[model samples]
Target chain A: MDTLNAGSVSAMLPSAFPIVDKDWELADTYTLHFATDGAFDFDPGQMVMISQPGVGEVPISISSNPDVHDRMSLTIRGSGSVTRALGRLDYGDVVGIRGPYGTPWPLDTAIDQDLMIIAGGIGLAPLRSLIYRALARRSDFRNLTLLYGSRDPQSLLFERELHEWRGRFDMEVEITVDRSSPEWMGEVGLVTSLVDRARFSEADAVAMVCGPEIMMHFVGIALTDKGMHPDNIFFSMERNMKCGIGLCGHCQLGAEFLCKDGPVFSLSRIEPLMKVEEL
Target chain B: MAHIIDIDGLDGLIASLKAEFDVIGPIVRDGLIRYGPIGSVADLPRGWTDVQEGGSYRLEPGNTEALFGFVLGPDSGKTNLFPPRAPMWTYREGSFSATPDSTRPMAIIGLRACDLAAIAIQDEVLLNGPYVDSHYAARRSQLFIVAVNCTTFATNCFCTSMNTGPRLESGFDLGLTEVLDDHHFVVHVGSEAGASFLAGLDQRQATSDELAEADQLIDITANSITKRLDTTDIAQFLADNLESPRWSAIAERCLACTNCTAACPTCFCTSPVDTTDFDGSAARERVWDSCFSLDYSYMGGDPVRSSGSSRYRQWMTHKLGTWIEQFGTSGCVGCGRCITWCPVGIDITEEMAAMRAEVLAKEAR
Candidate 1:
């Protein structure tokens, strides 16, 4: 065997990941599984490109935790032409994977610090990976809380995991909906509303919030009101990321490419992009 | 970095260079003089003109028997050097396929100052940014550019605000300002290729008076522009005007057809789509996409900027304000095609003026 040098290590890297499984998560939304040669490594919150034959590629955030599985998972929403085509894929179909790209969630940074995560709708998909990673290394962090909100009760994802996470006294998981029926027993309001009900020290605490921009804004405001510093808040941005490698200029927000510089950034660091009109 | 050549030797210089590389220049096609290969000087459009203003353009036949007639073309030099769409790689049978050869040496002639500046800006974005666009670098290395100072500004042109055009300053192998009165072009040799090209021409040494005339001409051309944008505090303007009624007004007339993006010189937004063939073969395509489209910002079965108002706001904000914060320059080149092709004639300069006036009115109140 070649002495496991850069060339040898690179040769073993998974350049193309084959689609082995796919499932519809909701109407026009999908969860796709790709078989990578176990050597393929990625941290949670990073995204991979899924390409369809004769159609095009769409960047899907890795929904599954990287520490536990040999196969990588991507949660994609059908909106544009590419995702619309991906929504039609079945098992054993193949899609190209470009990267495990972008700055991974600072799971290592969150160690020993209390964590508060707020995810809305599909935004929960990327946050779920971080949540799972946090659970895997639960002893490393102090307090863990997940606040999730969606359009309705039927649209909630990973319902079983939410129930399991709630059982642990060390962790708290709250699910809210914009609108709910009588059968729904959880909180009945936006995810931002749940912040007041949780208890945590603003010092040595960080909040990783991902969701609709408007929802994230409201959540950030709530966190600030609770004495969380802007530097302690993090959010993942969503743009029309055509090329995950930053070549296409589509995902640019101020000098940063959401693909290369960050899809995840501190609220303070990305303030310019947030303040700018289009980004 | 090499020898100097006189201004009169330009035609002979291009002719000599044609033997070694494909020489392309502006030619009349599709109602405009767009960049394409030329066999001889006769193939160039002799008399053409454009009426331009912010976001507006109209072509008219010109009086002077000049080869390059239009003020600026719809397509910038980008399509020649860095095409709108290109194949990165193709995968087949569980393996990657080799992309076709993208290397080629070509000489581009009659590139306007604004277009040349736009190319330089793209170089910083695509070739010299954090991650180099290898494809663009390959094309950029093998190409030669001959910059032409504008004789007149189009009505829609606003390169002055962007500090881009009406005069050629840098980033060219050769620069030429048309001076038909004396049947001479005041030329400036900027590179070795330019020096060699000028060596073959029958030209006279440029005197201080001649150079001064060129300066005066460039000043006149710059002043002829009918449009100007105050971009001094554009980022702050957009930030403050997020809830401005102008966004809704613009959206009310917008069809979201994306024609403006198609004609824009700096709009580089795109989206990828995939396709499969029989026998399990597959390919992915990089297609030009616009943020003006309603679906460009969709996430999780819901659209961000879903309303037409939001989409229009995104487009204008990205172009005039956010782009500056991102690329260190306003994305507009003052080419004026976006205004001309807007279908609804939603001029960007007018929008800026309205916003400026609105701000002033509020301050007065």
Candidate 2:
């Protein structure tokens, strides 16, 4: 790991990135689009540290398309202090940005195979990048299906994009919600139920999932139950982290630092760990 | 490669190092022998040794005037290298600028073998990662280590068990073995800087017999360590025993004081905090955080490890078990600071033995 001589990749100080646009995805969730300075780039599943000047930093996955140069979008929910501050920012306001850290979604592994992107709640944010990349290279794979679930129809992220994706002839998009409103025309049930109902070549497909830890866990089980190989099931996990690199030990799950070794990990690597209580 | 230097020669070596670097060595501070700035040999804690036991550490006058007689205090090279509080960057208006490393190049004198090993572990974490910590890298690049092989052992000292020490194998500028009988040091120069520094000291090549004496001196402490940990499949064992009842027992006695982690050399978890002033200049500072702290593992609402049982398990298992898988080596150096400084005397070795005993007892039945 003599990466020091490779080049300086220190994120000690974050560069200022201006918020070019802000989209309120939901009541609390906002997709803040930033004008990248072209200093660095990131992959679909890789996350960046977004910080407010007075508030602290939080690790948020890249939400927008990787091919889209000049602008990077981060889908953030106003849950904590840093994120809440980020939610309050408007276009032209500047915030500190460090990163594009952690392992990216193994998108190349999905080539020539069916790609199933399963997302729950805010989990869709990380997979949105992958969806964009996959759609761009649609001919490379056999089938591309997205089975997305939210708490409610109102809480659904990327509503406009989901609408566009569903209208596309090449890709398949199925939406589900736990509870339904009068305007809701989608299926009502757990995302796991959506996984069972979805059609895909399970044995040949690679499923990328993200959400709450428990949600991801059950989704992994659902994918496996649907005859998908556990190894083909990749998850973008979230944990408490300070340093997005492996320095801070907060984001540890067994031997893996979710910040470094993952944000994306196959079910084969982390299944045993998920079974252990409070691990 | 080796030199036999008398007491004055040792003093002269210190003087030479002091001239070039900000030399830090053990000195009596606040009734404890802690690593502090050493201007001269007089500043060193000579003729003093620490009596370390489970939940107790007392420094007293020893019979011999050995400069490096004591084992480790609460602090290690980590205290200086990866400080408890380090300002990373400051933000004003929009842009962020890193806090400059204005501190001088440092040379540590009397660093034990465990301390060196622990620094190496930290190097793997902070330096060998995908993104190197510039502050640690700067301090590490400018630092010189003068490791002293253990000639005496404390009750709490168990470096031999972990195979880290009693003898300074490498990772030092100069390695010293204090020959107690003759009041001289058998110095082993490990680097070009050490060789250059030794050229200025009043020293002579150690004879075959003197080298044998130094080996014998190291062996005395090495063999005296009664503390042992059976690390055979220890990682898997802890991984399997996560739900073991020992956690319950530990939770009963464990205070969750974070004393063990604070004293530990390889425990490198930190929390970044932001401070904003009236003038609108905000700074992000890193503070040493322990897993025992309720908020250390906070994600959204409640912390990951809320109970005392879970926190203790997290610390011990990570240090002895999962650390190997994480860092390619065991986290614990067996310096025994965790044992000695622990208020309830919660020994890690004893806990591991208890867990093993429980499993073995089940198998036997």
Candidate 3:
């Protein structure tokens, strides 16, 4: 507490600049690709707080694989003041970055076991990192299946990667839309329905899900119905996070600070709280 | 080392401390005893004590003419350390700079044992946690604490059950116990600075009998506390009974006014707000927040805790239950300010006892 020594004082400051190298517009959301300064080190499910200074800061998940350390990407929709400001930035613009905070997905638990990933809408952003990490270490994992659903075909993220992943012999990718137009040829239903068609050994497969809270809850029920253990299912939660280091109480859920203890938690741990209304 | 000083010597002690520090002590303000800067011994709440109960607090004349006769007020040491609102940093254009207020060393006098315990809880949450809040750290490191051993207990007080109050054992630079019968004060030096401060005062080594008298007085105050809460595994019990119907029953009368959390010395929840000036310069400010507030759990539109029931549950569970899990200690110091300040007379000890009773009855059935 001795004047918070210079090093610890600067911990909250987002001094690192990650310049946008390329930007892609997918429907209402934009994905910014940045070449890291080699100073940013993170895990697949870790996230960084990005700020535009005069505007504000928001926690965005690292949407790219951690193995690709030289580059990073964050897919953000224009939801709030900070995101709207982020959406306005052009290529070569600099955004302040701090932290790769929160517990990463339990990828180690899925090693040498069949893995299933379910994503809804833009919830696919954080899961994209896990998917890429699993793909990069494909030999270490058994059968891999990704069940993704969007509001419609246009809302799907990583469209190009989804196509390439479907062609890969080692990965099974299923694409679905809530409502599809005539041009769409894939399944049209909720993402939970894709879990029914997904073929995996319930006893050995680990499921990782990320989406709206309502969707994740239903998907959790579907996974449980398939004879999946509650401990084997992980879900990433979203809350108002001010300080990613857990000092701010904005992300508190029960005894846990989602920013520190988890953004990703096992169903067995959070199921009871999640079942309680307005908790 | 322990020292004894005549009751009149308090003026000289205050004068000595005022030379180098902002001496803050209990003073009568608007018919209430509150901690504020005291310019002289005249500002102290002399010959006054407080009558505190659920939904009421009033200042009353003390039977003995002692300066530190009052038990405690709504505010504690945390009001200065954490503060209601503080600027974390200022931002303009694309750069940000943190300006932590490190000036003005503070000498807080008349802190009760329970308040000291509450400050320790804040230290664990704000200073020793995974992240250090720079604002809290800068202010806390400069504090000079002078704790007062309680000689009186209000009806709402339950510090005996919490094992944190009515006597000063640790977490203070200097400790004082009033011996009104002898018209003197027994002082214990807790640190090097405290020893030096006592050395400068016109004081003498305390007699063993005088020290024993002070211990007896504190023991009397501790035993006089009638209010109590059974804390044996209470945290785990509350955690297990999250869905209990007692919460709804309490919610029927509980008002989410947030007064309890505001007066709570250890409730360290805060919200960061970003404000921009006309010149396009913006600064992020950290303000005290309570879980009882609907917006404390707001993500965007509807808050997670929308009902009075959920908000009340969140506050009690976090304070008496989950706080131990998160910070390795119970958040409640049993100071009883929450009970006195609550608008609807929702006593936390009563609720806890009721919950335990319901659990026990269910088990029996």
lDDT of 3 by residue, B18-53 (tens): 777778888999889888899777888889989888
True contacts kept of each: 0.33, 0.57, 0.37
Candidate with better DockQ, 1 vs 3:
3
Candidate maximizing DockQ = 2
lDDT tens digits, residue span B1-365, model 1: 22223333556667776876678888878876678888776776777787764445567888887655567677778767766675555567776553443444678888887787778767767666556655556667777888888877666778887788878888898888777666567778888877766766776687777788778988988887768888878887886787788888888888899888877767766665555667766554456788777667765465556778877777788778877777777777777778877777888888888988988898999
Candidate 3, residues A60-104, lDDT tens digits: the string is 998987887778888888877788888888876767777888889
List TM-score (chain A only) for every prediction.
0.91, 0.94, 0.95
Reference-based lDDT, residue A95, model 1:
63
**What is the CA-based DockQ of model 2?**
0.46
DockQ ranking from best candidate downward: 2, 3, 1
* Candidate numbers sorted by lDDT from highest down: 2, 3, 1
TM-score of each: 0.85, 0.96, 0.94
Write down the lDDT that model 1 would get: 0.75
In every candidate, how many clashes are there?
Answer: 18, 0, 0
The Cα local distance difference test for each model comes to 0.75, 0.88, 0.85
